[model samples]
Target chain A: MRPLTETETQTLFAKLANYTGTSLKNLIAPLDNGPNADRYVFRIQQSRCYYFTKTGKFRLHITALPILAEHARYKVWVKANGEMPFLYGGHIVKAHVGRWSDDCPEHQGVVVYSMNDTPLGFGVTARSTQEARRLDPTGITCFRQADCGEYLRDEDSLFATS
Target chain B: MAPTRTTTIKSKHATNKSGIQNSKTSSKARSNGSSGDGVSKKSAKSKRTTSKGVALGSVTGKGAALNKLRKKRRVYTERELGIPTLNMITPVGVEKPRGGKKGKVFVDDRESMLTILSLVHAEKDGQIESKMMKARQMEEIREARKAEAEKRVEERKSKLDETKEGLKKKRKRASAARELEGEGGRREEEVKGTKALKLKKTVSFA
Candidate 1:
């Protein structure tokens, strides 16, 4: 790899800022002159973005941070009973929703978490918070976009050499 | 501006005279001295002529004198001549940060951030929509498959029930036929023989 172009950087930063907000600055900051200083660079590989140090000794996936869930503006917590279903690639139904960030708009990106504050995945809201409140138990609250369970279920495709 | 323009014309005329003198001196040096010595002599002569031009300009008028002094000062101060001051060489040091606090590493402008975010969203909108559509199609196919499987299971259950009912009916008919034969003739012969045998045994013992 090569360094990201201006447009690519802007797009990446914009997507990341949705979850990390101003905290993204810390990730992009230049390294100070010191023995332990590491210059982090962003690169794209196989259509996926990677953030890694200049020495290639350490790397970070764009979505590797659990901190994103913690800082996300739009969030949804599934109840204990619903966590397994969500991990198994099921959408969040109104009955399974324990809580959600207030004023969440429909079709917005949302971080999915367990009731115990463990981040499971990320998804898009199917309805606004107000609309969700009026939905039936079986109505979908958020569509399942991706979850940690894919690490196991999709291990073959994820780790394929090709 | 007028004085500067006149000074410029005077400087051009002075340069023309100096060029002619340089040609004459260069020819004389070539005949009188070696190449290296001639170069040094030519440079010294040109310097003298430039000094003479400044002196002449100063003698012309007060404005011309100021102009000559200003030009001389600029030549000494600005290493890169003709370029605007704004385009001058940057000092050797850490560059000051832009569009943020003095020492901040990242730009924190909310308006720019919002615009970038909107641009990203617009670019991804079509992609997300296509993905969602595919997912919806997959869900529909899954639901159809599930319904078909359930229907097949129900059909199998109904066939199993019908077969079970047929077997029960066959068992009932066979049992009824056995009971009818026992009541009519098959059981009467065995009961009559038992009575006859008991009476004969009692007679012989008496």
Candidate 2:
């Protein structure tokens, strides 16, 4: 799979939160913006699974692009094969944000985490990508906004200490 | 409302008859008039009613002529007799003279019996209907009580289930704790038993 674009990383986490009640934090990867590169690689939290995509961010509410684009990529199979597309996510809606440094190799884009790898009492594992793929909800709606503002990454991030 | 349709025929005959105005007045006073009987109130049977009572004191007033007529008939029969006859004197074992005459006896016919039966039937039918209504009301009360009982039973069942679940959780925790504590003791006892048996065998061999 191609890496997730910055938009793709954002939308994936937002959907992970929407589909499950929790979302991922800091599971973002930067696309080199190299002509050959198409998107970024990001992981969603809760049900720790992985995905490669192109477009959006995790909003307090759901926004559409990354999900729409992801749907579009595998949507061809659903259209032609009349089968549902699959989901790819991970478990860490609580990944603390790291420095998104243009200076480091891994610190370029967004960083996200998974909740499943965390224990049960701590949080819950979202359903696996396989489970999400089997979901045959009728409406495959898209996003209303393209860019979602920044999300708080830590408990301290809320008040920076509050 | 007249409960029954009936026409009663009453005939007043002279029970006592005495031929004097004073006696007749007393006689009229003697026959107490039935209330609401218009004819009697009007003094309609004044003479007959008067005469009957009048003669009750004297025995020789209203029926004096009938007495004479009966005597005359008996005399005539005696004169016309062709056979030997006994003298008109009292004889032993003969049931003789009571002084007064008795009036005719009146009676109700059989059809009145049917009216009485019909009235009784109507009263009984009403009683039966009331009894049935009472039974239905009692049945309704029973059903209401049964429903109340069922609701109470269900509430009790739910409460019991909650208590059982709580007890089960508590018991599980207690048992798990006991098992952990007992583990070392049980293992130690087993080791001691094995050592004692080995010692016994050694002693026996020696």
Candidate 3:
């Protein structure tokens, strides 16, 4: 039940900024000395951060909203055959990649999606789009970091009551 | 009518033959439908015959007359009466109403938005405050440790100086004591030599 330190805040913000971009500022506005001060608070428990009202009700634990994916700059669309494999924690290969954000840089964070625009997960590009075009079909394109399918596969650890 | 009855009888015979074929082909079709194309074609032929048999039965049955009578009587409603129905005409630029279906727009209620903003503000402020406090504590600890180290270094330097000064004083005292011992030893030797000369002269006179 402690507050997040400076480094932890910076790391969290940096990761969130990748998805939310400038919209993150709207979500986390600076506190004002005016009448509407001290209404909410952030607390950490067992390494899980929570944002809640000062009255200890109406908490939001899943702070990273999915809308962030919509505004993300770097994106990779996986083919139908690759969707299941990506959800299963496999990296995106060239054969399974349907499309990608134009001029995406290598090693940058990217949001992964299905061909129909359903966001599947977040990953880091293994190669730039130009480099990926020259790669073999089996070559790795993006390395998956997390996926929405973890809700089912990692249910026990993700939703720990403790 | 006689021809139609003969066709019905022929279809009945075909259905019997199809029943036997169905039993024989069911197992083979179950294994692989692709390999049972001939069986499927036979089944399609049987289905066509069954449909014809149904048509013939309808033609001969009493229900056929009832179906004809029902088709002739036209039940007219508002459209036939030339009356306008309840379907409203949408205005030129107005979008059609989407009934019962969920819309894509995510509406954040005022209360919920306030709650979220407050939480964000609290988290940011608390994090910043905690970070500053931690940094202040670390700086204090660092200063304390540095001061203690410097104090220890000064103490060691003074102790080394005191030890060096004591060694120098001890060396000076040892040198001075050696010089005095040498002076006293030389005087005692000279007196002993003079005494020995006087004793020798007195012994010769006697």
Instruction: State the weakest 10-residue window (summed lDDT) of model 2 chain A.
Output: A99-108
Q: What is the lDDT of candidate 1?
A: 0.68
- Pairs of colliding residues, candidate 3: none
What DockQ was computed for model 1? 0.06
lDDT by residue for model 1 over A1-162, one digit each (tens)?
455545555756655654444445545444786755665656555444454244432232324547567566678999999999998999999999999987666677788888888899888789877668779999999997778888888876655534
Per-residue lDDT for A77-96 in model 3, tens only? 99999999988889999999
Instruction: Decide which is better by lDDT, 1 or 2.
Output: 1
lDDT tens readout by residue for model 2, B39-80: 665676576555655565367655666654543533545446
Using TM-score as the measure, the top candidate is 1
TM-score of chain A of 1: 0.79
Q: Which one wins by TM-score: 2 or 3?
A: 3
Each candidate's number of clashing pairs is 0, 50, 0
DockQ of 2: 0.00
Candidate 2 per-residue lDDT over residues A37-156, each given as its tens digit: 443243343322342222323333212334333322111112211111111111222122111111111101111211222111111223222323333443221111211221222323
The clash tally of candidate 1 reads 0
- Over the stretch B1-206, how does candidate 1's per-residue lDDT look in tens digits? 89999997777666544544455444564555555765878887788868877776766687676666765643445654544445557643544556865431342344444565556655555545565566556657978999999999999999999999999999999999888976767457656775443334343554
Q: What is the lDDT of residue B9 in candidate 1?
A: 79
Residue B204 CA displacement from its true place in model 2, Å: 32
Higher-ranked by TM-score: 1 or 3: 1
Compute DockQ for each candidate against the true complex: 0.06, 0.00, 0.02
